[model samples]
Target: MDVRDEAVTIPASEVLLPADLLVPAEPVGAVLFAHGSGSSRHSPRNVAVAHQLNRAGFGTVLVDLLTPAEDEVDAVTAELRFDIGLLADRLAGIVDWLATERPFGTTPVGLFGASTGAAAALVAAARRPDLVQAVVSRGGRPDLAGSALAQVRAATLLLVGGLDEQVITLNEQALDQLTSRAELRVIPGATHLFEEPGTLDQVAEAAADWFHDHLHPQPASA
Candidate 1:
């Protein structure tokens, strides 16, 4: 099961975002990851989840959502990361890029988002319903997606930490607005980051299973 790892620059929303892409041989599907606020493509949590997906034969894309200059500004104001519309626009562009790119052009695509990135992922899914097949949110702020929540057509899975009560309530509200196939699963003993022992692994496994179950399987090659 050879996996090709590439350090690439993706053109999204008129910006070039650095990303890490991993494609396993005969991948069943491909998933794009949107990191939370103050996080990059190098986020350890997302990287761990990507590796889990890779082992499950799913290609993964982890791209930085903001440019260097914007990141600098965001670091100071901490506002850009909370700008759901801007993030969604870039995420939607990345989805467009993935749809037309080589190897993944025809692949079933899914999205994995954490924290505020989850809202962007949801908004992007609503904007590109035909291209996106499934979505998973890890301790995310899906409520920030607003009215777009009702427009999402992808199979959505919301994973929240059991101890994160506020987010859980928000997710529940958003869950009711989702018209597509959706489910909410609370990870026991997990907090916002799932930093507890074995908690992150649970997130990884659940995400892999959801993507596997929802993303259309690739045809067997001769």
Candidate 2:
């Protein structure tokens, strides 16, 4: 299993976002990661999940949704991170890039989002139904996606922490609005961050299974 890991810059919404792209030899599919509020491409949690997916034969792209300057401002205002529309636009732009510019263009693409990034992923999936095949959210705020929730055609899995009652309620409410194949699984004894022992590992395993089940490689172009 030879793997290629590289740092890349993705053009999205008129900004260049830094990203880490990891692809194993003959990948089964590709997954793009959308980090949560105030997080970056280096998010340890997302990195852990991406590693799991990579071992499961999925290529992954972990992207920073905000530019460095914007991140600086966001750290102070805490407003840009919550701007769902802005984040979704960037995520959608990344999806478009993966479909057109990447060598794995023919491969199916999935999205893994965390926190508010989940809403952004859902919105991106709705916007690019033809390219995005599946989505998985970890402690995500799907309710933040608004009406875009109904437009998503991708199979979606929402992973919530069983101990995070408020987020669980929010996810349940959002589940009803989903029109595609959607399911919510609560990881018992885990909180919002899934920081409890072995909880994050469960999140990674579940996400790997979800993406594996839903995404498959397509015939490459001649």
Candidate 3:
């Protein structure tokens, strides 16, 4: 089925985040994406994975974590992305808005994050346990989630690259902090980006299964 698109304008401090909502023909759940520090809704890897998720009957919201002005400042100063607290707060705000706002009221919500965004995603889920149902991260720096890890009650799956030894160690360290039902899957022969052939598809498949397990099911199925 062809994926349909819609523009969702989320209010930030003085501006709005221009997010593209990708809807499938019969979506079973929705994922709110938090891309890496340097990445945005425009990241090809994320966009491709969003297509895969859409084909699997899920909707995707790829929002820019930073506004144009905020991004410009971070680009030169290179400081804000590390402020995981603020990013996670903004992500939580978006989730709350989805519940109270007109277009996205009460949709089954999940988080798909990568790199620094994974930290924010975990933090947001920790802060709002009732809203976020599950989380999937690809080649992420989940260590940055910090103390928020103890509060994440949702199921979380962290996909790390086997060859990226440094990040794998970091993920292991962070695993100790997480009290949630969490698992780390290391993709063999994959680097930080998992850009190696067929590696990313493995990430996508793992993500699909995780969401399928945790997302709200139909009455009959449940």
Candidate 4:
């Protein structure tokens, strides 16, 4: 089915975050994206994955965790981008908005995060276990979620690049801390950004499969 994509402004805390919402016709579930440091909803890599999710009959919300002003400051100072607590709080607020808002409120929700944003996503999942059903991390820094890692109830998938050894170790350590069902998948020949040809496609496919399995159940035979 064709998906309808729209630009939206979501109020979180005292700031309005810009986002792109894409809802497929008869979507099975919806996924919210928390982009990596220095990136916005316009991130090409995340946008590619969102498009893939949309084609898979899943809705997606690509949101900017930082406001324009904060983004400018973060660009110069590089401060807020690494503030996992603040980022997680904003992500939790967005999840709250999704649970109470129209059209999306009733849909099952998942989270897809990249880099440091992955830590924020995990922390948000820990904070709102009842609202978030599943989570996917791409080339992420899940360890930065700290003690919140053990509290996340959502079924989580950590996708790391095989070539990124240091990050792979960190993800493994974080995986050990997760009490919920979680798995680590490494994409061969891919680095931190998965810039290799066809590597990002692998990440998207894995994430789509994970969300499809966990977010909602398939209908029983008629």
Candidate 5:
């Protein structure tokens, strides 16, 4: 695909977050992406979604929720990514940093999270309602979010694969705790990873549209 944005790096709480900063030549808004368990800024799936969002004229940030050393340990034991509190706090710090940063300062922030990262993203958005405008989750473990569910004020979309029965049920269980405008979507013929052909792209497109529709300049365009 053709390049449409610049990549940048920033310091998170404990780590230097490597990010793929996608800026639409003529940007509309911005979203930060949180990958699933054991994934990083280099995840092809998240990168795919970022590409779609960039094409839709939205800026995107795909960054590491953990530091390099932490990620190395987490990648093997899958322990670091499970700490929702720590991850969410890191995400919140990143948002604050962006608020003070350049181009990102002018854009509304949204979050796109998958799997366990979805919970972290939700918690982060909940903690900083003044920053995040909207949120989207793909095959997420919202139930893992615990009480953070009720803290989220941003409009949220939870997308699950049709065959991801367990995760779907978990999301349903988690929905009752949410106080925000939230919806659950099931993509047909998809598995946990949504690796069935174009299903992943479908997910990416859906997320981009959701963020675009829900996130906008504050005070509404009246």
Candidate 6:
């Protein structure tokens, strides 16, 4: 089936966030992507993953959590990027927006986050347990979510690069705190960016499988 793409603008905490949305003729679920520091909906790496998800029949929304004005200040201060509370609030707002939008409102929703965005995703999941069905983090900093880590109810997948040992340890610690179903998988020979040959592909495949398994279970017919 052919995939349909659309440009959308979602309101988040008084900012208008630009996003790119893709949906198959019949989608199993929807995944909202929260990019890492210094990245946006235009990120090539995330766009690749979104394509994979779309092929798997999962609609995807790649959103910019920051407005153009905020992005500029964040680029200079590098502070907003790490503000997990602010990021999480914005993500929760987007999730709420998705729940009220057409077509997308009925579909199960998941989250795919990278870098510090992972922490924000976790926090948002904790806040909106009714809306977020699953979550996947790529080379992320889930540890930064703090005490809220235990509150996330979504099935979560944490993908890390084996070569990134420090982050691996942090992910392990975060995994321990998570009360929900969670698993950690490390890709060998990859760095923090998963820039090694075929590494990002592994991350995408793992994420797709996880979302497919957990997001939208078939309902029994009457």
- The whole-model C-alpha lDDT of candidate 1 against the native structure comes to 0.94
Off by over 4 Å in 3: 102-105, 217-222
Local distance difference test, per candidate?
0.94, 0.92, 0.86, 0.92, 0.86, 0.92
* RMSD to the hidden true structure, all candidates: 2.4, 1.5, 2.6, 2.8, 2.3, 1.9
Cα TM-score per model: 0.96, 0.96, 0.93, 0.96, 0.93, 0.96
**In candidate 5, what are the lDDT values of residues 141-166, reduced to their tens digit?**
98888988998999999999999999
Q: Is candidate 1 or candidate 5 better by TM-score?
A: 1
lDDT, model 5: 0.86
The residue-level lDDT of candidate 3 at 194 comes to: 88
lDDT by residue (1-222, candidate 6, tens digit) is: 699899989998888898888989888899999999999899899999999889888899999998899899999999989989999999999999988884554778999999999999999999999889899999999999999999999999999999999999999999999999999999999999988889999999999999988897435449
Alpha-carbon error at 175 in model 2, in Å?
Answer: 0.3
Mind giving the per-residue lDDT tens digits that candidate 2 earns over 77-144? 99999999999999999998998887554679999999999999999999999889899999999999
Winning candidate number (lDDT): 1
Q: Residue 102 deviation, candidate 6, in Å? A: 3.3
Over the stretch 1-222, how does candidate 4's per-residue lDDT look in tens digits? 688888889988778888889988787888999999999899999999999999888889999999888989999999999999999999998988987784554768899999999999999999999889999999999999999999999999999999999999999999999999999999999999999999999999999999988997424449
lDDT of 1 by residue, 1-222 (tens): 689999999999999999989989788889999999999999999999999899988999999999999999999999999999999999999999987885554679999999999999999999999889899999999999999999999999999999999999999999999999999999999999999999999999999999989999546568
Model 3, 113-197: lDDT tens digits are: 9999999999999988887999998989998887888989989999999999999999999888888889999999999998899
Q: Give the higher-lDDT candidate: 1 or 3.
A: 1
- Model 5 root mean square deviation, Cα atoms: 2.3
